[model samples]
Target: MAVFQAVRANQEESMRTLGQVKPWCAGILVGTVLAAGSLVPSSGFAQESVSVRAALVKGALPADDPSASAWNSTPASEFPMSPQVHWPNRIQEVTVKSVKVRALHDGQQIAVLLEYEDPSQDPDDAAGLEFMVGDKKAHFAHGQPMAQVQGGPVNIWYWKNKDNNALDMNAQGFGSLKVQDQQDVKAKGVYQNGTWKVVFSRALSTPDVEHDTQIKPGDFINIAFAIWDGKKLESGDLKEKGSQKAVSSWWYFRADPPPDYSAYYYVALAVGLAAGFQFVIIRKLKKGATS
Candidate 1:
């Protein structure tokens, strides 16, 4: 009986010592993994912004104006236009999120849902999102909020062509937008059937956002929505018989755009709780064996 008690006592001490050692191992391993992951390249942004209510989701009308032909938006089966995007990857297929607006006077909220079809699937090559911040010229994380960078004509748009693939801004709001690796025109591109979700948000860097406003969080816009599409080159202009075209989508939020408030909190929580916790548990086992 005395031996039995002694054995159990030893076991408890062993466990306690293991516990203290666990944190040390965990802290080091986690820190190391994080450091390495940081070095490895990833998408410019971590979590992407979702479909938001569109103050304006505009695509340049086909120079030919296909809308004149008239097509049915109410499809019995699926989207009418196939993934006509010249190169699906050029116009990255991603889910747009909800956007909200608020009143400046009374701080009222308006909500509108924005949904888009993300048919793009070329993970090997990807497109980019760009905006202006002033004369300094800044870049936006692929899924970060869009804000007015300059005081006057604070325009923001990304390039679509190979040469202009980088994001650029011009006063016209349309001059900078061009297709990349463009070839003879086909059914250029379309955002066929896909998941639809929306978010409620407030404007970020517009003139109104910078200035003091009565609006608070949770305010939403009523008519918020977005529509995005890309264009192609003329058929005869292309030299190759089977040349391809590329297109892109531009987006905007209406009713007072919202600041991205949840990315930092959500990403940290996921990595810290799930990934971070797993590291801690593994460490406990290793230390126990060492002791």
Candidate 2:
């Protein structure tokens, strides 16, 4: 009888220990899964795994237009910056780690609003905007100065706030930069509340212009962005060290179709109809009762 009692007590203790260990084991497993997920490379921006979508809006999109207020309702994708390619081994401490981009397009026009933080708002030679547009998709390091993919042809729209209100031109290959005698690109920049909001807009298609890349609706294109924080003294390869100093460089962004809101409209219409019917039924019941 004594031996049996001791055995039963041991069994109960063992069961209690197991119950405590089970929770710890589960917690460990959850922690391991979360740690592994964090190790994966992601910009933590909205819809980064999938292509970034642009929302289509009505009417003409002017570069200087306050229409970007509409983009506030659109989803934004975050773009991260890394060091330029010239110095591969050195990790750069970039001020602009991420840029928030929202795009809007009418069938005939497309515009992108780039919002980033810069305390200085350097209007001097320090601040500039670089836009790379490609019709076809290909993989290549966009960090290289004048970088180009073997099969992909990219058209560049370069803008400097200190310069004329036009965009400088460049192509994929080296020595392809051509500053136009006249500017076809429309750009308007505003620095307010320690953030620079710049809008770049153009027609969907521009033919017979070597510098301009023709764009169309429902077309899949590759876009990349670079920003020079003048306060950081970021310019391209100025020191001859083969490094383009910039606060940030975001490359390899794929453009998705504009957001479609048709389903929401239909839903609203259905709800409105249901409410009207309910109201009419209530009124009819009240009239019958009074009569």
Candidate 3:
């Protein structure tokens, strides 16, 4: 009879100990499973990409307004700029160290806002957006040499502070810049408090497909930039002199696609599975403790 009592006491203690550990075990299992689920490539668990995203908006985009309230809704992608040293008339000094870029799309048109600091608002100040074409692989400086035009061509949307609109241009090499016959790019710029704000806007697709880098929604494209500070006498038209400018390397630009809710469903499924697994494990532990 004494031996029986001892065995009963031992079983009771074991059950109590298991009861104390049950919750902790279940919590650990659930935590680990959920952490793994979060890593799944679902929209709910997706991280931001390294490209400049043009967010789609319901209302009209602020085409030429740098201070428009519509622009406040989008996030900015800041890129560092360096002196253009690949070609002749290279920038000896870097005046513009960085540029803050924001983009918006209204399904039909897109607008890009570029803001940078400049101590003086020089009349010769100009900004440009350049993208690759043809082979889509060439020197980012502008393009390959004219003799090697078959290598690739580049489309440029050049905007000057003195002009009411941006110029549609193209180039194959350093001194091979030419204005396009079709002008579809529009731009406006404002300077205040030692800062310059410029906005460039155009239709998502243009008829001049030969010379324009046609932009499409939900597409990834390579792009570069240049800024000519008039105070420094940087010139885009005169390749022989004053060609020094701040430039950027190739970067990606993408228009955000429509929302996908399938990821939410997957996340919900994963959470359900984790809860079910925890319940099963706890049930087995409880059964063992009781027995």
Best by TM-score: 3
Query: Which residue window of length 10 is worst by lDDT in model 2?
Result: 236-245
- The candidate that achieves the highest lDDT relative to the unseen native structure: 3
Q: Is candidate 1 or candidate 2 better by lDDT?
A: 2
Q: Predict model 3's lDDT versus the native.
A: 0.80
The TM-scores, one per candidate, come to 0.20, 0.57, 0.74
Ranked by lDDT, top first:
3, 2, 1
How would you encode candidate 1's per-residue C-alpha lDDT over 118-145 as one tens digit per residue?
3342211112222333333222222222
Model 1 clashes, total count: 35
Pull out the clashing pairs in model 3.
Answer: none
Which regions of candidate 1 fall more than 4 Å away from where they truly are? 1-55, 58-218, 221-265
TM-score of 2: 0.57
- The candidate, 1 or 3, that scores higher on TM-score is 3
- Is 2 or 3 the stronger prediction by lDDT? 3
Q: Going through the candidates in order, what is the number of backbone clashes in each?
A: 35, 2, 0
What is the Å distance of residue 146 in model 1 from its true position? Answer: 40
